[model samples]
Target: MTAVIENTAGQGTNTGRSFEEIAEIIGQVEDQSRVGVCLDTCHSFAAGYDLRTPESYRQVTADFDRIIGFGRLCGMHLNDAKGELSCHLDRHAPIGDGHLGLEAFRNVLTDPRIDNIPLILETPDDTRWAAEIALLKQMAL
Candidate 1:
C-alpha cells in the first residue's frame, strides 16, 4: 500500500502529514515490497514543502531520498497549488497557473527519479490536460 500524504489539514490534523512520519511508518518496514508513497505536489506545498525554486526543489527531493528512499516513491501527483505555501488548503490548481510557478513543475519533470513512477495530473482543468501534457513533455525533454 502506498501511504499518500493526507496534507489537507497539515499540522492541524496529524494523519500522514509529513514524509518523516510516512518514512517512520512505511519506510522502516522490513518487508518493503508492499509499501510505498504517492507525493501530491499541492498537498506537499500546503504542508510546508517548497518546490518552487530549483534549489528548494532539489532540497525537498533530496530530503525525500534521504528520509524515505527514492525507491519507495511510487507515484507523484502533478498539480499546482491555489493557496499560499503551508496554507493547509486542499484546493487544486492547474499546472503553472497557481501559487506554484512553472519552474516547480519543470524541476519535477526533469528529475531522473520521476522516470519510473507514474506522474498523475491532479489539476482541475481537464480541458487543458492535453496542453498540460504537452507542456510537461516539453519540460521533461
Candidate 2:
C-alpha cells in the first residue's frame, strides 16, 4: 500500500509536510517496497511545497528525489488547490482555475520521471474532468 502525505489539518502538527519526514516514516519498516508515496499536488502546495513554475517544480522534485527517491513514488494525485500556498486547506479546484495556474500543471504532466505511474485527478469539478484530462495530455507533449 502507498502512503500519501496529507495536509497539516489532516495529519496534525507534524504531518508529513516534507519528503524528509515521509522518508523517516518509511525507514521504520523492514521491507523497503512495502510502502510507497502518492504525491498530491494540492496537498503539497498547501503544505508549502511550491509547484507554480518550472524552476520551483524542479527544486521541489529534486528535493523529493534526494530524500525519498523516485523509486518510492507510486503515483500522483493531480489536483489544483482552491486555497493559496501554505494555507493548509484541503480544498480542491478545477485545474488551472484556482491558486495553481496552468504553468504548474505543464511542469508536472511533462515530467518524464513520473511518466509510467498512474496520475489521478482530484479536482472538484467532475464535469470538467474530460477537458482537464485533455489539457493535461496536451501538456505532456
Candidate 3:
C-alpha cells in the first residue's frame, strides 16, 4: 500500500504535512518494502517543498531521499498549486498553469528516478487531460 500525504491547511495539528512526518509514518509500518509514497506535487508545494526551480527541486528530492528513501517513492500526482510556497492550501490547478509553472512539470516528467512509476494527473479540467498528457510526454523527451 502507498501513503499519499494530504495538505495540513497550515494548521499545526495535522500529520503528513512535512516530509519528516511522512517518513515517520512510513517508518512505523511493519513491512516497509511493500509500502511506498504517492507524492502529490500541489500538496508538497503547499506544505513548503518548492519545485519551481532546479535548485529547490534537488534540495527537496534530496531531503526526501534522505528522510523517506527513494525506493519508497511509488507514485506521483502531477498537479499545480494555486497558493504560494508554504501556503498550505490544497487547491490543485491545471498542469503548467498555476504557481508551479510549466518548467517544474517539465523537470519532473523528465526525471529518470520516477521513470517507471505512475504519474497521475489530478488537474481540474478533465477535458484538458489529452493535451496535458501530450505536453508531459513531450517534456519527458
lDDT of 2 by residue, 1-141 (tens): 555543232335656777777888788877777788888888888888899988999999999889988888888888888888988787788898888889999998888887898899888878999999999999999
After superposition, candidate 3 runs with Cα above 4 Å error: 1-12
lDDT of each residue in 1-141, candidate 1, tens digit only: 444443332746666657777877775677767787888899899888999999999999898889888887778888999999988888889998899889998889888879888998888988999999999999998
Supply candidate 2's per-residue lDDT for 12: 55
Candidate 3 local lDDT, residue 44: 88
Q: What is the TM-score of each candidate against the true structure?
A: 0.88, 0.90, 0.91
For model 1, the superposed segments whose C-alpha errors exceed 4 Å read 1-14, 27-30
Candidate 2 backbone collisions, by pair:
none
Among all candidates shown, the one with the greatest TM-score: 3
Q: What local distance difference test score does each model get?
A: 0.82, 0.82, 0.82
State the weakest 10-residue window (summed lDDT) of model 2. 2-11
lDDT of 3 by residue, 78-136 (tens): 99989888888888999878999988887787778989988899899999999999988
